[model samples]
Target: MNSLDTTRIRSYFDFPAAGRVVTNNAASTQPPRELIGLLQRCAPWYENVHRGQSTASRRTTAMYEASFDTIAAWLNAPGRGCIATYRNTTEAINAVMYSLLTDFRDGDNVVTTMLEHNSNYVPWHALCREILPRLGRRVELRLARFDATGRLDLDHLASLVDKRTKLVCCTGASNFFGTKPDLSKIRAIADAGGYPQPTGERRALLLVDAAQLAPTSALDVQALDVDYLAFSFHKMLAPFGVGVLYAKRHLLDHALPFLYGGDMIADGGVTTETVAWNDLPWKYTAGTPNILGVIASAQALRLLLDMVMPTAFFGGSGPLPRVAIEEVMARVGRHTANLTARCMAGLSEIKNLRVYGPEHRTPLVSFTIDGISPFAIAEALDRRGIEARAGCHCATLAHRALGLDPPATCRLSFALYNTPDDVDLATDAVRETVAGRRRAGRPRPGRAQVSTAAGRPT
Candidate 1:
């Protein structure tokens, strides 16, 4: 049980107007002081790394490689596993897709779920579109459906896997509902020789996209039996432009590199005609890497593991355990049977509102006020100094699937920093917005009238 100091946590971020009433731990997060200082120190040294003959370039390259070691430690990956520093999760996913396609044949299938962010979806879909035709093969996209509560239907996943299945990819925690998938169970099902299905296939490799889960909890790869895992630094409290991909050693050696360029070779020296390739990390890094961001990421991770343990690290109950970190999260989960309960509890008082996503959810929720466009809702909140996001959230498929009209949903995500007071402010702002619109007597098309004070629509 770690004792969390809310006051100390409060001092770290730059809150918005209205004394920072609007807060979110989604999209990205505020890094520590040391991360800022580290970036500031390296700002000027942003010259091309590994290309120069100078001592400074050599030192920078060393720092860059050292960052991989730090990332490996944080991820608890095998020492032999190759760590490729990427621009972001998108690039890493692309690399993985391409590399997997190099070895996997047309008959081989890779399984993913509906829960994936676009970052994980697009690359593979692109491969399926472009490569499947060439090889005369078919790629199957399988989703493990969830119940009304957003818990993954493991039984559904078990039904999908067969001998041809080569890779199984899934998100550790859902960004939409904050639902945590049971990876251990997934791994076991995949690896079990006697697969439930009629096919006599053994286990498939497991790839976890831990982008959302890593920030809130410690991810022990060995414990989870994950073969490959990828995540970004910016989401975890560092700046953007840097990401990490942990691929088991055998996979690294067998997989092909996505981008081809200078550093990724053993020797690209031109003797009128000569070219060779470099090893693991270098092979995948095609251009001048984001040295400063990589350094900052390494430093930021160290800071989180060291200084910010209370809120980000420790989890339990009571004074000894820290309420804001663990206990509150538990209460939030318990307070509502699902996302619908939790969000409705907060927004039921607000007139003309509709919540989106499964009733069972994570700390994040998206909703829309009746007859209000998402953009208008966001602007209204901004006027009241309530910070929120309005857009597709890079999930066009999900929006289309949900049959959303008028516009995209307005998103408000919670983190350890968010208090119950924050929820109250957000709910009140929605109520005020709806009431103010009604007072203006503007007819909201396809929208129903309701009493705000009564909480739910009469």
Candidate 2:
């Protein structure tokens, strides 16, 4: 497989200059200097969209609205009407829940999986357990289990879906296990449920949390046939605070607005009798939106193509071709997979280290040492200038299901800009930390006292 030019890609970001190994990409990626520069270039045109008649308003509104088109083209959506912006993935999923709040029937259930992040799971959990119950609805929240290898148990997931299932929420990829579930299969399972919806469809809606999947994979929303898909741009080299929720155009038209205010209403169409909502995409975008963030985030997608391919596609405004997107992301997947393989191979040489998930995974690895706390291992790696994450990573259900008390693991994730040398440096740091602990006679503690420094049990 061909690899990305890591040297050239690294030069686009300022992090590498500080000698930082940014392995926590699953949480968020380092923003390119060009995206920062793009933010500055957009400063002079700053104005609220759909609010005023000034030139700045017209210019900024055009760019902001065009951003929706760019994002829609990135995901191969029908149009910008199907797209909605949010603070992050968590808020995007929450918007879905709120929009469909009154749609759930008394006996309907929502099927989810242990492989989902908390962003995907918690909202449904709250919907069924907390919110719906008070409204005299006994909606069920069913959870599918994962297999020993951390893969989503397809059979278990199939059993959880039935005619009464209203929605099936699953992660496109596990941030902890690094496992990318077969979304097509999940979509089929959701379809087989045959639940009648207000839109006259007879299939359960499928919502995919693509926070991890979108960064390294070519995700075509129409090809996947997902009812809704959400992801954060920060996970794909954009500045924090911009995420996308792509739904079917019809779904957006029928579903109620999550947040109702300001520009969401029709232009001077509000009155004491009734307030007509605005057009598609705009109705979902309530209030003064993040004008600069949306433009920068959309440009970040363009910059990502340039960073991966040996070409210049940034600083332009137009539709990104599906062929170019597929080729660039395929190269990114291959490079990160290679790095992950090397890192896992090197970690296997360490005695008593237990890595989670399958041998082939997305671009990250989470593992635990038999005698060492994950926090201590993370701290030691930090001392060696290796940045790693130690926590449940919002995969709390998966960690708890695996019987990990306090529910945490140390993770080292990679991005397109990370090189093989970065993987070697990380694994070597792990080896030295383990060996040093052994030489220091640090005995393994009992379960009762084997707590994380944050006081969570391990």
How many residue pairs clash in each candidate at the backbone level? Answer: 9, 0
| Residue 329, candidate 2: C-alpha displacement in angstroms | 0.4
Give the range of the ten consecutive residues with the poorest summed lDDT in model 1.
314-323
Can you write out model 1's per-residue Cα lDDT over 1-458, one digit (the tens) per residue?
34434455556555522286644556776666667777677666656677888777877777777777667666666652468888887788878888777556656666777667888777767777667668776776665666555466788888777777777888887766567888889998678523222222356888888887776666667778787788888777788788788887766766678887767777655355765657766777787777888878876655543343434422111122222333433433342223335455878666677666555455677777777788887788878877888887665555655567742778777654555666777777878888887778754778766867887654
Residue lDDT tens for model 2, 266-316: 888889999999998999988888878888899888889887776566877
Overall lDDT per candidate, in order of appearance: 0.67, 0.92
| Leading candidate by TM-score | 2
Question: What's the CA error at residue 37 for candidate 1, in Å?
Answer: 2.3
